[model samples]
Target: MLFALGFYTLQALHYYSPYFSIFAVIAYGLGISVSADFVCERLKSTRASFMGRNLLTAIGAVAAIVVMVFTIKDTPPTASNANLAGLAQYMRTSTDVPGDFYDYAKKPSYSVMCSWADACKLQYLSQRAMVSSANQEIGIKGIIASERFYQATSEDEALAMLRSLDVKYVVAGGRLTVWHGDISKIGISGANPDKTVRVLKGDELPANKVGQLMAARMVWSSARLASSGVTSPLHHFRLLYISYYDSEKPPLLLYEIVKGARVVVKAKPNSPVAISTNISFNTRRFTAWHDSGTTNEHGVFSTIVPSSSSLVFQLNR
Candidate 1:
């Protein structure tokens, strides 16, 4: 099992392989027992000597156990790890029922797109389905779809991908800023069509990792893509909840795929209609986003815009 992935590559993962580690522990244990036995053979066959030998053997066993325990890394390795409890609770009680989803699924459920699909604690706690996960569990197509969705640079393209995947929710944040080292940034050669590496500009992350980084950056930028030079809060996706998380390990942010309210505007024939709106949800971190569309021959233009429950409720006013 150890040789299957090659001796050098097994160290790539932070989590140790149980099979390999167990074998290693057993081999070391046998060696320790043999050493203890050999040393005991040289001792006198008296009661005191027997007692001393037994004591030495017990000490060796305890030392071996201590070494194994001390070498083991803690799961997730940090207290600052993102908390999925709040997001899980919301997914369980609140999300859209089974009706807004596909026909095959009859039970009340929703699919979520997560950053680390392999760590399925969120799904297990919430009892929800995932759009895709690591290791091609949902198939290679699902992984491809997920990668395309994450790497998308445009909101329109991202929305289309989400809609196609039938993902109603998104799980972003939690090590989204991870630098995948040299292996991740190795882009396929544009000229050769072969697996070739390209020289990327300084601090330029790979295409696959850009969206994850952007998601984390967006949260810090007050739910807006300021770094992208955009003033819009993600129009189609609304932030439903931000789980309890640490500074270094950001919280898992839950977003609902929303169909913004359709608003029609009237203008002169062949005139351009400038559209803009102000929005805020978690806090009064208000931001305005703008868009423009040309009016049709009827001097009318229709567009979808984000609306909040607070806007309709009198208490928030």
Candidate 2:
């Protein structure tokens, strides 16, 4: 058994042919043992023979000990060493997230939009829901949907897509700030076919494309705050926005805005309900209104109708 173990160890060390080494070692040991037994049997009556046997055994034991020591010393480092102290420190500090930042944990079930890598970390630490994880276990359709949301040309389109997915808060960060020319275009075709599948120069896109992306304002940015003496990691725009576009447009202007720790929207009666929002309203004191049961082309029905003839609802987060 000891010889077999030693043979296996040598094989692991890339010794010449495992089978050959095992056979050779076993044959050599057997030959030595047989020869020693024969000689001992012949010299069984002699004290010198007993001393010689003891001396041989001692030499073999010493050789085994030396081999074991060298084998242990030559062993390579493990893969676990890749995890450094800095990595642990980074993960520990990430959990010290600001309260003012969007907290998806408050909601019963809602998705927070962020890069896949950050999403994985936040999901683990916060125990909150996310749009898609870094592992992409949500499948290809989910990946394509998220890609479309990021690649959206207008706030309306982006909000509409978010509403479709029932997403409330959108997160912006340095990892998300891709240059126009550096954005990947290989996977699925986006809304803009001409620029969809290729990295595009800034000038190549339509005039409104850049403006629409800029409109999603940064409500909180960690890097921006740190520059002004706030101690935090250096990453641009670790901001969370309520994703409101202050435009008198068709889809956006028609919905009732609900902004709290996150944002929620309720479509007016008989108005288009292409957008959806998820905000926690249980803690606040607010009156409930009746719905007219009007459904849009998207099959989204109105939930809250105004009690008074003319009413305006506004909230700050």
Q: Which candidate has the top score in TM-score? A: 1
lDDT per residue (tens digit) for residues 12-97 in model 1: 22223535654555455555566666666666556645764577667656655654564353232222233665566566676765
Clashes of each: 0, 0
Name the 10 consecutive residues with the lowest summed lDDT in model 2.
Answer: 247-256
Which lDDT values do the candidates have, in the order given?
0.52, 0.38
Off by over 4 Å in 1: 1-82, 97-109, 117-119, 134-136, 139-142, 174-222, 226-233, 247-250, 267-302, 307-317
lDDT for position 292 in model 1: 63
TM-score of every model versus the real structure = 0.48, 0.31
Error of 1 at 255 (Å): 1.4
C-alpha positional error of residue 237 in candidate 1 after TM-score superposition, expressed in Å: 1.4
